[model samples]
Target: MINMKRRTFLKGSVAAGAVGAAVSAGLLTPRVVLAAWPSAAFEAKSVDSALDALMGSHAVESSDKISIRAPDIAENGAVVPVSVTAPMSNIDTISIIAEKNAAPLTAAFKLGKGAEGYVSTRIKMGKTSNVIAVVKAGGKMYSASKEVKVTIGGCGG
Candidate 1:
């Protein structure tokens, strides 16, 4: 009975130690696990410019496969829900950009095989602007956009 209990405790300790090490090493960081952040795209002035920087010059023409979801009229600019979904095989990434916002690009998502090419989050809008969604699939770039009207300032307009 004592040996069995000791063995169980040792197993638990080893597992806990491994988890702690992973977390400390940043292997379990939110950004790592979530695979978010491609800052260059979000900071670009226009959708084309951002996509050029992110997907490179080899990118092809935009397609309708990419979808941008957002309210046509945002009652409040502070927290406007936005979602991007690209229905394409071998989708490498998805990016969101707010055209009129000060920062422009909002978020980027890197996806793996079998991973869903979708992301939903709230982005602040300085005023009415076009929210763009760019998706990289099979070494090509596809994009879509929708205009969102903001009632109150969110990005400090």
Candidate 2:
């Protein structure tokens, strides 16, 4: 049996508590705590509003450099696989928009400097809609869209 003395236990607990307090106070940090998780953007009813909430504006130009790899007809809307790739320069972020969903903004991926502009994930869709991929590069937004037809509806039919 490992016997932890009362004084030693109290000291250890106090040290641990102090460390936690320091982290919370920004004294020790890489800043892992996310108190600002963009809830308003995800809950937005329309695509424009979602984009505004997320990135301050929705105006974006079409770009041939961007490509979306998704099935022309998704057998199930519950987990339709989608991938966006942009073999371009200076990509800052990649955001996916489901144009007809209740909350159109489905996913947003922020990239570090020089990181590859590519993301893949499964997203839910309520009906047939154009899935738009918006990429931010050099402080400008470029986009591309692909119509995805769903067979079995996922977002509340």
Best prediction by lDDT: 2
Clashing pairs in 2: none
- Evaluated against the true structure, the overall lDDT of model 1 is 0.69
lDDT of 1 by residue, 51-83 (tens): 444554324466777788899999888889999
Residue 1's lDDT in candidate 2: 22
Instruction: In angstroms, give how far residue 95 of model 2 lies from its true place.
Output: 0.5
Residue 32 accuracy (lDDT) in model 1: 38
Candidate 1, residue 56: how far the Cα is off, in Å: 2.4
Location of the lowest summed lDDT over 10 successive residues in candidate 2: 26-35
Model 1 C-alpha RMSD vs. true structure (Å) is 16.4
> Cα RMSD to native, each candidate?
16.4, 14.9
**What are the per-residue Cα lDDT tens digits for candidate 2 across 1-157?**
2456666556645644554454346553322212356665676666665665566557788998899999898878888899999987888779999998866889888887668989999999888899999998877889999999987733432
Output the lDDT of residue 104, model 1: 70
